[model samples]
Target chain A: MILTAAFFSAAIVAGTPLLFATLGEIITEKAGNLNLGVEGMMLMGAVMGFMVGLKTNSPFLAILAAAVAGGAGAFIYAFLTVTLRANQVVSGLTLTIFGTGFSGFIGKGLVGEIMTVDIRKFFAPVEVPLLSKIPIVGQVFFHQDMFVYLGYILAVLLGIYMYKTSKGLNLTAVGENPAAADVASISVSMYKYLHILLGGALCGLGGAYLSLVYVPAWQENITAGRGWIAVALVIFATWNPYKALFGSYLFGGLDIIGFRIQGSGLAVNQYFINMLPYLVTIIVLVTISFRKSKKNSPPAGLSVPYFREER
Target chain B: MKKQLSFLLVAALILSLVLAGCGGNKPAETPAEKDMVVGFIYVGPIGDGGYTFAHNEGRLHLEQELGVKTLYKENVAEEDQEVMNAVADMIDQGATVVFATSFGHMDGLEKASKEYPEVAFMHCSGFKMTENMGNYFGRMYQARYLSGIVAGLKTETNNIGYVGAFEIPEVVRGLNAFTLGVKSVNPEAVVNFKTTQTWYDPATEKEAAKALLDAGADVIAQHQDTAGPQQAAEEAGAFSIGYNTDMKAAAPGAYMTAPIWNWGPYYVTQVQAVIDGTWKAESYWGGMADEIVALAPLTELAPAEAAELIEAAKAKFISGETDVFVGPINDNEGNLKIAEGQKLTDEEMLSMDWYVEGVKK
Candidate 1:
């Protein structure tokens, strides 16, 4: 039971960034734009957040700066794909390259620079009042950092916005068949732009969480391709925000199992355990395809740039 | 629409030009046009805060000491095509010496050296080289052993853990030396190590460190690049040893000591040899005695006796009283590695894939 709780705690720490990126990407994909730039955006967000947090010593401002940086990246992609009709895949790839390069250029100066701030206490465990008295479950869920709590809240809010609201239906329609949505005067471009920007902002917040709370050290390319894992997580979650949270934590669990189960008399190869996340992603993708629910499929027009002039 | 297409094309062309410009920082000014231009191809960005950062520090030292114009391409992949292009570009940019600073970059460096015989080549931690090429690395294991003494004295659980970057001989050698130091000081302690299989993944490094913490290790050490392991140890209320640099700030409470590289002086010496036209293709391996690798200052978390213990060992290294790979050594499996009174040679140490008695991989 102790080991299990320890493992769950590790999962929360590992999964928070992935959850942020997956939910962010889900929103963009739901608006018919498949942004492959999450990795780039995350790096930009990480460095920008680190800079702000270090300079201002204000976590809130740092988080905000990261969001803006990420959104700025998305803004360029939106203008290229949505306004200029550039290919979505190409534009997204370009954004990734741009973000990675720009972040590295700026971060080179701060290399080997250490954060002397004692802001770790701010990100330290916050136990829920009263619920903390409970046993294993309480310790695992209620005792976590503010960023982990934010991940939960974001998933919940995103789920409601995706499934329960009228705006959600309109956005889904725009993604499914933009011409029909346009005929109904739904303003397809507005939804695409807004959702894409929102996605970018959320992705940025995810990166800020990494730099500000998780790891809490400055390293170049600190996202470490976890942004790509987050992108894969969107497919695993089947566009459901809540499922994305679960999937992210699942990857997180697989990530640490190699270490967690060590010296428990189990003789497992660490390399095979290390491959669990990607291997599980492939398996989940295949299983999702076998499902009969069409709702479980990707956004109908994802990666397609809509052209009003052609229609 | 045709106008829009042309406009888009123009935008893309401009963007490409800007990104291409960002790829290589302008080479520092050449005081004399005839001064040799040295180039570097780094495996990761200079801001990696780990291996690449250490190398760049050396390059900066080279520039300052030798006054040679230096050019470098950060984030160059060790993949054949990318490194080849980078090397070719550096040569075109008038580089007389190109240093490829990654083991994975060895094949690419070999190819580049063959193509440009006139241009001297240097690599870090690899064996293969041509007449105009040389490989240089410090005996980081010596420093690793000193840091291990810190961990051995500090750990209350008698369980030590290491987050190694890879299973290569260099890392293996460091881990063995560390285990030897640990057992030498605290015979009851054993060191368990796991590989992240990556040089610079902070997330995985932290998780691996945490996993070790959960496994009851009170002392954590890392061969990985980032300070992730140190930070993780601090968060878990455990002690840690860092690598590549002083990681005291990364984990103030947990950091005990670290094996650090002082590449600046080494770079000066190597470049000076080249300037004197005495450069050879011999593999150069310096140690603590030469000050190529040294132990970072012991953190306050280290035991009171730790400093004295580590310092005595340091004096032994400097005075030629101790060798890192000395006799009566046994493999982790209890098989005899070195006969009593017989110290292992540089050739044997360089190819070591086995662990010392106290190591559990």
Candidate 2:
């Protein structure tokens, strides 16, 4: 029972970044832009975040710098795909390659470098008063850092914003049919630019969350393909923020479960256990494709660049 | 329609050319045809300051000692087609001998050796070899034994954490050797292991070390390709024994000693063998006596008697007076692995799959 509680706790810790990145990409896709540069943006955010966070020793400042850097990283993809009218897939992939290389280059000196400051206390778990009396639920969910609570609030708030607000409907309209949205007087470029930047910022924050609250250290490729996992989670959840939250946590749990089960005196093959997450991803991707609905489908104008004059 | 067809053809041509260019990723450097060049493929970046860094140092030494130019491709993913492409590019650029580092590069190295029969291919830490291909690794377990002695004496908790990269034979051998050293000095000491199953992930390595520290481990030993574990030990104010290279700079306050690799001598020999037409298919496993594996300098935090113990052990190993795997060995589950008065053969040592007593694997 104690082991079960710790395993679940580890799940939430691993899933927080995925939730953040998925949320960012969902918002971006809803704005009619399929930005596949989440991995690159996350890497940029991770290095810059660690650099700023380590230098200032202030979590807030570090996160802000990471977000800004992530935003700046996405600005390149936005400019190429939105302004220059480049192929979205090509531009996004280039951004990933460029971002990955640039971040690695910048992080060259920081590799093997240790932090002088101890920022663990700042990002440490803050148990909720009175609610801590509960069993596994309280230990796993209620006893988390500000980033987790931020995830809860952000998920609920983003869900409401997507389904309830007039602006969100307008954004959805732009993704479904940009010409129709333009006819209805919604600025396509404005929405795309805003959401892309917003997505980049969130992805950056996710990266910061990884380097700050989770591991609280800096290293090259520290995101370790988590950004790519977020991309897959977005699809697995069918662009729903709530589903993304649950699915991301499940993956996070699986990541830790393999080690936990082995450590619990099982003679299981570690390789087969490690392959669980990717194997599950394939299953998720395949199952979701069998059922199609208006709500379940990807945005129509996702990878298509809006050309108002062509219409 | 004709103009549109021509445009499509031009686009296809441009696309193919661009794809071809991307496949060649290496810079189109036209070296003097007569210049003798050796190629190196690194799984991680050279700046990693651990595994790749150690190999890069050997490459630099090989260049200086042999007066030959060395070219390298860094950050090549061993599992990706990058390995094949990088090796092919090296061949195209007139490389005579290629050193492919990382176990994941095994299949690729084998394929490349068969394809480029004229080129001498050498792989690190792999078991595969061909007519012109060879695999070479040092007996790092000897140095690991010495470092373990330091950890056993230095640890007040008698609990040492080992952050292992994988559950492979090399790592298992190192773990057993280390446990033996620790037990020889401090019989009550026990080693716990946390495997990340990755070679160069810093964050995971740190997390494993932290978990060990949380479990009351006072000393951290690791086989990963980074300084993250060493740094983790530093942060936790615990002692560390790093692999591949010295952890003195990575964790000055926590560094005890490291089982380090000095690949320069072997690399020079390989290059000289190729030049002298004496290159052959052989599995090279040099030990402490060969200067291929040695312990780093003991830091101030290490036990005072560690220096003397290591000196005596080093001399014994050099003189074949001691074998780390000699007789009376028991697996971690308390099963006798090697019988009394038996010396473990190279095959048993190479394919070691069980943990020694005192190791929580």
Candidate 3:
């Protein structure tokens, strides 16, 4: 029973970052801006957050720095694709490459340096008064670190903001048909810019979670292609914030289930076990391809740059 | 105007690519200006805080002690072509001696050795050797055994966990030696072993450790590089044994001791030999006596008797009184793998594939 709880708890811990990054991309795509630079932005965030955490020794300041760094990276992408009329795919891919190299260059000195201040305590699990008394659910859900709680709150709030609000409806229209939205008196560029920055900030938070809560230390390329996993997760969630949450946790669970199988004294090839998550991803992707529900489809204006004069 | 702007951007991108290519082809120093240069090619980034970090530390030590110009290319992929390129790059930079610190680099280094007969090449943790190339590895299993003793005594629960990187011989040998150490001290203790199949991935490694702890393992030991498992042990308030380097800082409360490689002394000796024209191609597996491998200082988390026990075992290793693979050993299936009053030869130990009796999966 304890092992089962540990499994779910570990899944949540692993999935929190994916949830944040997926939600960020979903928001950006809703504004008709397909930002493929999620990996790059997260790397920027991871390195910057670790640097600030080392300097100020404050978790809050570190997270803030991470968001700012990620936003800065997005700003470059936004300018190139949205304003300069460059290819969105090319621009986003360049951002990934640039952010990766930039983070490694900047984080060179932080390698192997022990944290002067222990921020693990600051981000440690805070047990809720009455809720944590519950059997398995409370221990798995309420006993998570500050970031996991924040991820839950953010996912719920974003779900409401994306579906229930009038602005969100307009954002959806902008994604489906920017010219129609422009004719309907919505500022397309303004929405794209705001959500792109917001998306980048969330991706940055995802990166911060790894450097702060996961490893709680600095390592180069620490995100380890998780940013790309987040990109896959955005599609797996079918553009719904709640679904994204489920998908992230599910992905996280599949990632570590192999160890649990081995821990049970079962003799299984570790390679095959390690391949479980990606294999499931491929199967899910294939299954999703057969379902052509319009609601489940990607944003219409995704990867398409808007031109007002052409309209 | 738009067309001109796009054209200019394209030109800039092409220019940058050309410039990058030019940088790669930069000329080496003239013969008279050339000095003794040592090059290191690593499989991972120096900041990985595991294997590469230890090697980088040794590189730094070599610089300080020998006063030689050193060059290193970190994050060099283990692919044969990439290793060859890295070696050629170092040679182009006038490196007289190159050390490829990864097992996967053996094939590439062997091929490079024939290509560059004048230069000396050293590969770590592989058997392949050429006239100008040699392989070197420390007997890390010795320290693994000592740390296992510490974990065995420290654990209140008889379940001890080991986070391994792969199913390779290096990791398997370490795990077996560790289980033997644990059994020697506490016969009832069982060592649970699981592989992450990755050298360093903090998130997954930590999860593997957590799974072990959740399964009632009160102590953790790892053959992986990252401190993820150690940090997990610390969070669970369980004892841990670290590898590659002294990782006490990663998990102050959980850390007991670690098996570490002191490559500076060995690197210096090899480089000095090359300078004196005494370099040779031979398989060198140094043990505690050579100081190439040693156990990290035990923290207060260890049992009081851990110190004396570890000291006695270490002395035996140093004095050649006993080795880790001495027989009366049985595989986990209860099959006699090594007969009584016999010992495993170096060739046998290098290719160890089976688990000891106390190891569980």
Candidate 4:
């Protein structure tokens, strides 16, 4: 029982950052842009968030600064793809390169610096008396940092906004066929820019989670490809926001299982156990790709640079 | 168009003037000029707060004490061509002495050293070297042995965990020495080893440390850079030994004194040699006597008796009265690799690949 509780706790904390990144990428992909630069963007966000959090000693302001930095980065993608009609894939790759180099250069001076934040001191967890006392499910669902609860709420809200509203339908139509949506008097470009910026902001928040709440200190390459895993989860979820929440938890479980297995003295090879999550990702991708039925593929016009030419 | 052209012309003239001013202040050369420009190429971001952090601290010491002009490129990937390109760029920018600070940077440094024979090349933790190239590393095993003395005496479970970075000789030697040191005191202690191929992945390092703790190990030690293992040990209520630097602050309750490499003194010596026009290529493997390898202060958690034993061992090592790997030492396979009353030759120690007795392979 204790071990199960420990596993669930580890899952929730480990999954928070991935949940943020996946949900952010899902929104961007729905806007007809596939940003391969999520890794780079998250790295920039991590560094900038650490710098701000360390300097200001305020987690809230650090997250805000990170969101702005992320939005600024997304704006570069917006200009290249929306304004200049550059290849979205190429532009996203270049953005990642720029972000990695820029972050490393700026992070050089932050080595060995200690960072402190008091989010829990400012706002404590609210326990629901009966709900908090249940079994494994209750502890997993009810007892978590504020960010874990927020991630679930964001997923539900995003799902409602993507599928249940007229504005959501219009956004979906634009992603499927921007030219047809534009003919119907919808501003396809405007929706694209809006969703892209929103996605960028969420990614930045995810980065702040690393420095402010997760590791809560400065370390280079700290994200450790969590951003890339988030991007992979976007595809694994078939671009659905709600599924991403569960997918993030599954990845988190796989990650923590290696340690759990090693702790048990099961005589398993640590290398094979360490490679479990990555191996599962490959298996998941293969299963999704080889399914016999027609399923949720990406939007038809996604990654196609929009121009106002003859239909 | 005319305004733009005139602006371009003025900008070009000003840029050249600034460049000339920056380069024109070289002091008048004596017949025997004694100045050196050193370059460093790093494999990871220097702000990793672990391995790279320690190396960068060494570089800074070189600058402050020896007054050498230091240039460095951070986050250079381990690809051979990319490393060569960075080395060539540094050489073009006037690097007289270059230090490639990773095992993967060895071949590129060797090739570049051959291409530019006049330049001195020092590769860290690398075995291959030429006339103008030398490998330099401290006897980290000596310090690890000292730390293990504390682990052996302090542990209640008689089980120790080792989170290793690679299967390379340097790491293997550290593990073997640590296990031997532990067994010297406890006799019944067993070391559980886990190797995570990379040197700086904190998530994996942390998990490895936790796994070791879970498997009933009461004390943990690591060869990786980050304090992940230390943090894991603290969380798991187990004691830990740290590497590269003093990590007592990271895990106040769990930290045992760590084996640390003090590169500052070596950096000061090497840079001074370069500046005095007396630099020569030679492998340097210093230990406690020279202060190249020293132990961090024991944390409050270490037992009083254990601390005493560690101090005694450290004193013996510092006074040149003890050798950690003397015969009759048996390898892991139960074969006697060194004869009774015999110390290993320098060449034998350099290429050591086998674990000593009581170390799990």
Candidate of highest DockQ: 3
TM for every model, in the order presented, reads: 0.93, 0.82, 0.95, 0.85
Worst 10 residues of 4 chain B by lDDT: B24-33
Better of 3 and 4 by DockQ: 3
Q: Tens-digit lDDT track for model 4 on A1-311?
A: 22676576677667878888888888888889988777777777877887887788776787788888777788889877887678999988887777776566567687566455255233234454687789877777887767777888999999999999999888888888899899999998899999888888788778767755565555777777788888888877888888888888887777666556543547677577557666776776777667833347777778998888856
TM-score, prediction 2 = 0.82
* A1-311: candidate 3 lDDT, tens digit per residue: 43588799899988988888998999988888888999999989998998999898888899999999888888888888787867988999999999898888789898775444567778888997898889999999999898999998999999999899999899899899999999999998888888889899999999989888888888888888889888888877878899988889987787778888884656677678656656766776777678767788888889898999988
Residues A87-188 of candidate 1 have per-residue lDDT tens digits of 988888888888887888777776666553656677788998988668977888889988899999999998999899999999999988898899999999
Q: Each candidate's fnat, in order?
A: 0.67, 0.31, 0.78, 0.39
Model 1 over residues B1-361: C-alpha lDDT tens digits?
8698879879989999997877547743434567878888898877777788788888999999888888888878878778889889888877877888888888888888888888888888888978888888888999999988888888889999999988888899999999888887999999988888788888889888988888789999999989989888988889999999887877888888889988889778777877788877778888888998999887678888978888899899889897878989999889999999999888888788898898877
Q: Which of 2 and 4 is the better model by TM-score?
A: 4
Give the CAPRI rating of model 2: acceptable
Where is model 3 chain B poorest over a 10-residue stretch in terms of lDDT? Answer: B25-34
Q: How well is candidate 4 docked (DockQ)?
A: 0.46
Give the local distance difference test score of model 3.
Answer: 0.87
TM-score of 1: 0.93
2 or 3, greater by lDDT? 3
The reply for model 3, stretches above 4 Å from the true place, is A1-3, A115-118, A265-289, B1-34
**Cα distance off (Å), candidate 3, residue A285:** 4.4
lDDT of 4 at A184: 94
